[model samples]
Target: MLDTDTIGYLAATFTTTAFIPQAWLTWKTRRAEGVSLMMYSIFVVGIALWLLYGLLSHAWPVVVANVITLMLASFILLMKIVYK
Candidate 1:
């Protein structure tokens, strides 16, 4: 049986790795015309909360995932602000 930490680790890996490409694309393309500022802002806040929770829980996977996600999301949010 898979342990809880193992599961979280795997889940976090997939979830985070999934975003890196998109973030890289967005970073390279610098396209935010179709993106919504409100949505990205809300998402960034949520990710930040998750990061905090992950820190409090001392979950390595959660912390790692959230850090990357927060970085990506914050970049998108910044693009939203700068573009729009």
Candidate 2:
């Protein structure tokens, strides 16, 4: 059976990894015209708050996932800005 931390990390991996394709595609295509700036703006903020929460709670999985997710979300947001 997986431990709590293991499970947490697994969950984190899935959610965080899920964004990679979108980030990569945006980075490569330089076309975020289809992306919504308002959504990403809100998403980045939410991810930052999640990172803070993870830090306060000492949840390594959450911290790591949120950090990476934040980066991806921010990158997407930046792409949107640049491409818009």
Candidate 3:
């Protein structure tokens, strides 16, 4: 049988890590000219909801990944506004 915990951690970590570079680039460059604020706003909100769901369900993988992603996404969104 597949280990759900292991799968969750791996998938979450990979997806969340994939987002890091884009987030870091946006923050470092402060040029989100090509990025869609509306898209990211919705995405971040969705991630936040996922995080909440993870917490309620006591899922560490979901919780950890979404929390980090939330921070990164929120940072980029803020930079998008501030730098614009």
TM-score of each: 0.84, 0.96, 0.91
- Model 3 earns a TM-score of 0.91
* Candidate 3 global CA lDDT score: 0.88
- Angstrom error at residue 1, model 2: 0.8
Number of the top lDDT candidate: 2
Computed on alpha carbons, the lDDT of every model, listed in order, comes to: 0.83, 0.93, 0.88
Best by TM-score: 2
Question: Model 1 segments beyond 4 Å from truth?
Answer: none
Better of 2 and 3 by TM-score: 2
What are the per-residue Cα lDDT tens digits for candidate 1 across 1-84? 999889988998888777677667767888777777888888889999999999998988899889988987787778767766
Weakest 10 consecutive residues, lDDT, candidate 3? 21-30
Candidate 3's residue-wise lDDT over 1-84, tens digit each? Answer: 669989988898899888788878987787889878999899999999999999999999899989988988898888888888
For each candidate, C-alpha RMSD in Å?
Answer: 1.5, 0.7, 1.3
* Candidate 2 local lDDT, 1-84, one digit each (tens): 899999989999999998899999999998998899999999999999999999999999999999999998899899999988
Candidate 2: TM-score?
Answer: 0.96
Sorted on lDDT, best first, the list reads: 2, 3, 1
Candidate 3 residues lying further than 4 Å off, grouped into runs, are: none
* Candidate 1 Cα deviation (angstroms), residue 26: 1.9
lDDT of 3 at 41: 93
